[model samples]
Target: MDKKKPKKVFVQGAIPPEKIANSIANHQSKTNIGAHSIFLGQIRADEIDGKIVTAIDYSAYEEMAEKVFHEIRESAFSKFDMTCCHIYHSLGKVKTGEICLFVFTSSAHRKVAIEACNYLVEEIKAKVPVFGKEIFEDRTHQWKVNK
Candidate 1:
């Protein structure tokens, strides 16, 4: 039996807008898909304790993260009637307003695609072992925690 290989989720830096557009464009050939949902995670310039965040530096245990990502994909496939799914997350530094993560899902209907897209993003955030360092304007940094 043939199986689809797991895709590499980590990118070197910020996910470009063009990449996201290209992904959508590439799916136009699939005639069965009627809906597509996309989620984009962008770094915010947040202020805390008199410091302002300028960027976010991300890192992860690649082996473990890849395994978790695969698991998430499998779970989504089993849970939803999804036609396709794609996830891309950035490593290294992503400046404020830059995209750090992208999740795309397609299905025959709108609800399935939207829910699957949301599920993928939530699972990636809650399950993946990715860490972020919030870099401040003063060149100082602190670890980020998801709320």
Candidate 2:
């Protein structure tokens, strides 16, 4: 993978399982990679104020978000000895139990891969401009705050 090029990090809706599977498959050819770490962020149906969250509608300032994503990727590469890193985030409605974010990192050792993946996830949550609206089952909604 070309680390210098910016990848399209946002997906239109919930990320499909096949895309994740394909990513893993694609990395099989890289014989030097000894460890791979993956993080999947799934939407949860949480009861808040007696209402159940049915989904999260996500949105972002695309241009700015992409810039942040690139910076996160670069930072991860510089901080850890990662062979490759990829991140995908959902942009539209993602239902409870659906995947909203995916982060994959690979390296020659387990520690580096794991640390890079965790770093990417934390940086994204802390720095990205993405917003999420929690949609309740009864049609009510509230803006989500990262915790």
Task: Name the candidate that leads on lDDT.
Answer: 2
TM-score of each: 0.97, 0.97
What local distance difference test score does each model get?
0.94, 0.95
Q: What is the per-residue lDDT of model 2 for residues 51-143, given as tens digits with 9 covering 90 to 100?
A: 999999999999999989998899888889989899999999999999999999999999999989999999999999999999999999999
Q: Which ten residues in a row have the lowest lDDT in candidate 1?
A: 1-10
**Predicted candidate 1 versus true structure: per-residue lDDT over 1-147, tens digit per residue:** 115678899999999999999999999999999999999999999998999999999999999998889889989999999999999999999999999999999999999999999999999989999999999999999999886
Model 2 spans > 4 angstroms off: 1-3
Q: Give the TM-score of candidate 2.
A: 0.97
RMSD each, Å: 1.5, 1.8
The Cα RMSD in angstroms, rounded to one decimal, for candidate 1 relative to the true structure is 1.5
